[model samples]
Target: MSTTDCIITSSVVPDELRLNVLPCYLGRHYLTGESMVYDWAARLCSSYEGGHWNFFTLSNGGFYMAPSNMDRVHVRWYMNGYSDMMGADAFGITVTLFALCHLAEHTLDDVIVTRYHQLREFAVHHAEAANILRAID
Candidate 1:
């Protein structure tokens, strides 16, 4: 197995806000000797990228307009290494986006809502993958 560690990073409004969201799935797979992490990470990353773009478009720049407190909250939450940390981050982002859309007198159309659902699905998939990997370990 490879000795390289996995580095999962996330990008937000500002470059300085970038964070390592989680350990690399490759490293996790190597450590756990389980294939699920690789499979799930591929799936989750694809879904996450798509959802991110969809929400980004809907924000019309409002997403980045969040207050300093919100940004700080996100940065701190993302630093944790647990898998559920991703889920919380996902939920928090979704909620913040929806709230911002409403506060801006904008409606979250079906597309945006669908993207949130996609993110939720991806989170569940990741959770299942983690559970399976844990079981095998």
Candidate 2:
């Protein structure tokens, strides 16, 4: 699929107010120590009915999503900064995924979750990252 299509499909959800939809860009910013990102995400979540959206902070960043089923998630990314000496830079992207199960489980709930669980059976697995991504995706 095209990149835009993939992103939209992953982030799209029913027009309900119970699901959590956190874009990847917001999540990354929150993880990278941007305080304003969290505030914006919180405000966006609060705008929904029934307090559907909620903000979550992971070790690496923050994300916004609905707390129940029937909610949608949207994310976008942008360039933040880069390193001149190391030729490195910081960038971001928004990501969305099915989150029906996360609302009730306090964990991931989708195809990604299954894949992560399988990956975890092996040694040297990033359980924490996997957990966060699983929910975000």
Candidate 3:
């Protein structure tokens, strides 16, 4: 595994006016292992550029299970060598707040809103699916 394998970033508006938003990206095989940052986030935010797939979506409900015969992409909430604060769980949330302070100069308002909705909808669907599957088992 790479050293920096998990990273999260956020975009905050009205810096002083915090909102109840949880913008996060959970990159499994999606993220490169060497850095604590995901391949997609690094590419999107222009942080990392060693990936073949540049366009990745954070709106796929966050949970990605490996299809039959495919390589496993673990849902990593934290790395073994990292501290609690540096964990994906903690970083994901923290990056959201920290990102707010540093807004992308070119990021559109509509785009941000749309992405937020996507994240929310996916979260709901993913949760329901998990519950249904759990009940079935």
**Best of the candidates, TM-score:** 3
lDDT per prediction? 0.29, 0.28, 0.27
Which of candidates 1 and 3 reaches a greater lDDT? 1
Best-to-worst order by lDDT is 1, 2, 3
Worst lDDT window (10 residues) for model 2?
85-94
Q: lDDT: which is higher, 2 or 3?
A: 2
Kindly report which residue stretches of model 2 are placed more than 4 angstroms away from their true locations once superposed.
Answer: 1-51, 68-95, 98-137
Question: Model 3, 79-137: lDDT tens per residue?
Answer: 22221212222222222222321222224344334444443333333323332222112
TM of each candidate vs. truth:
0.23, 0.18, 0.24
In model 3, which regions exceed 4 Å deviation?
1-50, 54-70, 79-110, 126-137
Error of 2 at 110 (Å): 25
Off by over 4 Å in 1: 1-108, 128-137
Positional deviation of residue 4's Cα in model 3 after best superposition, in angstroms:
38
lDDT of 1 by residue, 1-137 (tens): 33123222223533333222112211222222122222333332333321221111122212211122221111122223323323434433433333322322333344434433433333334334353222212
lDDT of 2: 0.28
Prediction-by-prediction clash tally: 1, 24, 11
